[model samples]
Target: MARTLAEKVWDQHLVRKGEGQEPDLLYIDLHLVHEVTSPQAFDGLRLAGRPVRRPDLTLATEDHNVPTLDVLAPIADPVSRTQVETLRKNCAEFGVRLYPMNHAEQGIVHVVGPQLGLTQPGTTVVCGDSHTSTHGAFGAMAFGIGTSEVEHVLATQTLPLKRFKTMAINVTSKDGRLRPGVTSKDVVLAIIAQIGTGGGQGYVLEYRGNVIENLSMEARMTICNMSIEAGARAGMIAPDETTFAYLKGRDHAPQGAQWDEAVEAWRELRTDDEAVFDAEVDVDGDALTPFVTWGTNPGQGLPLGENVPDPEAIVDENERVAAENALAYMGLEAGQPLRSVKVDTVFVGSCTNGRIEDLRATAEVLNGRKVADGVRMLVVPGSMRVRFQAEEEGLDKVFTDAGAEWRSAGCSMCLGMNPDQLAPGERSASTSNRNFEGRQGKGGRTHLVSPLVAAATAVRGTLSSPEDLV
Candidate 1:
């Protein structure tokens, strides 16, 4: 039978086929653990007296609650300390490998997996994280699971899930790529803007065409990481020479002759020419520009040069209501220029855009430039290893020279879990996913942007793009 890339990967991992409404039991190739969600799952295993079924396939890291500054000192927050300690004790008891804070491998679970090359083509990956779709950049069928599902996977190394319908997102351009200053982050924001947040519900999105294929692995990861915001089961890009090049010589990737064999198999993971998708969406790469959200949801976005949307002008009743509510919550005036909105903070780091490449881009923008006096800029790497690499390349100096704080890695400012959060009523231009109400902290406002935009916003003290700096 003809199959899509997602379908082929799904079939390869099926332990048992489903009939009627029965869910198909699929084998999990990699299970990632973190401090926030694994506690209850580990406790469940303890109560049931069950050991982890595949310790070798499981990896844990400290990220959510770890301090990005003063890493050597004891955790000042008692609640965070307990969570980190609990993960240590549980991993020891369950025989799962853990990379604790200050360790080189320690960072966001999604970032660590790909950097180590454990994420591969035609594999099934799961984690207790919504951004697990980040692994789909390698052509893996990855998705986030709840605490109970976490327990199920830990004890059995398998999960029973209903199959997902496939959707193709074809991105084409007159020049075969995005223009300078526009990036993968803009591409994804444009997608969510075109398709409302629930547009991809129950579907697995496969990104294709010249625009997608030309992106670096890190850029592709950024694209997939935000799939959850679009309400998709997951997002993926078929593995190609770019994928193999990124994996080569990584710590966990296959070596030598095994590498050749793996590549050969990975080449067959593409969709068949005659395979059909459940739906299709087309995006013009040439028409896209640097995009930013003006409202609470990812879909409430416009081009950098556009003005805030007028809710009264919207014809759809529900959309108008949402726009009105979003404007109220965001403190934005309808029809005002987006560039004129002042920002109090600028954050550049997260699973969505905190790779070495992202840091390099930010540094390039900030080179010989100074941050606006009233704006505070924070540059937290995605992982300890990423921090090391940036420092080795002197990117850290560039950040500090520009008055941005260069902190240690671990999901900082991406959520309310860590100390790096926005104060009440604070507004920021951030290079992170999800700008929902209080996503960064209670009563805080966020504008989702790319690293280049973040750097420029830091310099201008407003929502901006690199062109504004020029």
Candidate 2:
């Protein structure tokens, strides 16, 4: 039977199908966890006198609650400290591998997994973190689950899930070229804007078309990382030569002729040219620009040089109220030019855009420039592996020299589980996902932009595009 990559992976992991009553049971290949969500699950396991079914398949890390600054000390916030401490004790008690803070291997869950080659193609991966879809860049079926579901996976190494419809996003280039300055972030923002936030509901979006195939692994990750925000269970790109090459000889990737066999299987994990989809969306690569989220949700966004929408212009009163409130809280005047907005801080690191390529791009802009006065900019690598690679190429020095604070790899300010946070009423240009009120901290206003915009904003002290800086 013909199958999309998502279907192929899904079928391979099926353990059993209920008698026309519920969903199929899926054997999970990898289970990722973080400190913030695992404590309750661990306690549940203890209460039930259950042991983790496959400790080898499960791994945990302390990203959310770990302090980015002063990592050597016990965390100052008691609640944060407890979260981190509980994770440490649970991992030890459960025999699951853990990468604690300040450990060279520690960082964001999504960042650390791929860096360690733990994310392989044609597998089912689950995490307590929403960005688990980031692993779908490797052609895996990955998604986030809630705490109870996290416990279910830890106890059984499998999950019962209803089937999802399939969506194919075909992105083609008119002249066989990616429009200049049109990045992966722009591509996804355009996808969400076109489909609306709920477009991918009950579906797994598989990216197709020449543009998707041509994107680098890092770029592919940037696209899939936001699948959740688009209301997709997960998002994936087919595994091909690029996928195999990226995984070859990585620390956890398959090796020897096993590697060769893995490649063959991954190569087959693509949509049969004739396979059907529940729906399809097409995007012209030439039409995209550096995107920025204008309101709270990822769906409320616009291109650079655009003006904020006036609430009165919004047709839906509900939407109008939301827009007005988002603008008011962000301290952005409605209908004002987005480019004219100033940023108090700029952060360039997260599972979304904190890879070596992201760092290199930010460093490119910062190479010969300095951060604008009073702009507290930070450059955090998504993983220890990224940190080493960046430092090897002197990208770290470039950022620090440009006045951005360089920190060890971790989730950092992406979700502010750590010491990296925004003060009340502080506005920041961030490369991470989610811009909800208090996402970074109380009264923290977030503008979701690309790494290019983040670096440029840091340099200019305002929301900007790289072209404007040039």
Candidate 3:
């Protein structure tokens, strides 16, 4: 049978089937936990008198509430501190390993998973965070779960789930390859623009075609991480040479002859040419351009050089009203060029763009330039590996010397889970995925951009492309 990539991997990991009585039992290969979502799950484990069925499969970290500036003291926000404390207590009680705040291994759960080689191809990964799709870069079937589901996995090391429909999103670049200036961010934003916010309902999107195959692993991750934002249950890229190369010698990747066997199995994890999809979408990679979000949702985005859409021109009254309100809250003028808009802060980290390539792209702009006087610039690595690499290559020095604050690895400002956040009324140009209201903090306006755009904006103190700095 011609099976989809998702199905190919899922079948390999299924421990039980969906009979008349229960959902399919999916054996999870990795369970990433963070402070905000793990306490209750651990407590549930204690109450149920169960130990983590496979502690080796679970990894915990303290983020979202960790202070990026000063890790030595108690967190100032009492609620956040309590959350972190609870996680520490829970990990201790369960005998599950944890990367505490400021520890070298501590960072965004999604980021640490990939960098440490925990995100293996053909694996099933789950987290309490929605962006777990980021691990799809390695050809894993990864998704986020709610608190109840989190507890269920903590107790059973498996999930009861109904299968998702398969979809193929083919990206074709008429020019034979992706354009020079456009990025994976542009590709995803272009997709959202065409399909709207709810396009991929009930489907697990599989990226295919020449353009998609050519994207770097990090780029592929950027595309996958926003699948949920497109209303897809998850997104995946078929395991390939690029995927194998990226996982070859990582800390957690399978080694020796076992690696060869793993690779052989992963090679079969592709959608057969004759496989059918419930839905399909095509994009011309050449048509893509650097993109920036203009409103509250990630879908409310436009090409960087494009103007903010005039809400009045929107035919749907409801969408128009929402746009109008978003415009007001964002302090943006409708119809104004998004690139010309002023920026108050520049953030270059998160699960989305906190890897080495992201830092290099940002550092390329920060080489000799300084962050604009009033604009606060933050550079947080996504993991200790990324941090060590950046520091070894002096990327940290470049950021600090460029006048941006270099923070420890964590999910800083990605969702305001930690002390790194935008204060009320402060607007920021961020590299994270979402731009929802209060996503960073109350009244904390956010504009999503590429790492290059983020770095350029930091120097210019305005939303802009790296070409402007060049």
Question: In lDDT terms, which candidate is top?
Answer: 1
CA lDDT scores, all candidates in order: 0.95, 0.88, 0.87
Q: Write the per-residue lDDT of candidate 1 for residues 347-441, one digit (tens) a residue.
A: 99999999999999999999999999999999999998999999999999999999999999999999999899999889999999989999999
**Stretches of model 2 off by over 4 angstroms after superposition:** none
Better of 2 and 3 by lDDT: 2
Clashing residue pairs, candidate 1?
none
RMSD of 1: 0.7
How well is each residue in 1-470 modelled by candidate 2, as lDDT tens digits?
A: 67788888888998997569788999999999998888999999999999999999998887777666677888899999888888999999999999998788888899888878999999999998788999999999999999999999999999999988999999989665577666898889878878878889999999888899889999999999999889999999988888888889899998998998888887788888778998999888877888898888888899987998888898988878988898888888887899998999999988899899999889888889999999999898887778889999999889888988988777778776678999999999999988889898888999998888898899999899889876
List model 3 lDDT by residue over 1-470, tens digit each: 99889998889888999889677999999999988877888888788898888878899987677777777787899999888889888888877889987687888888888878889888999999889988887789999998888888888999998898988899987655766656787788778777878888888899888998888899899889988888888899997999889999999999999999999988988888888898898887777778899999888998888899999899999899999999999989987998788888899998888888989988988999999989999998887778889999999999999999998787788887766778898999999988999999888999998888899899999988878876
- Give the candidate number with the greatest TM-score: 1
* Over 4 Å off, model 3: none
Which of candidates 1 and 3 reaches a greater TM-score? 1
Residue range with the least summed lDDT across 10 consecutive positions in model 2: 174-183
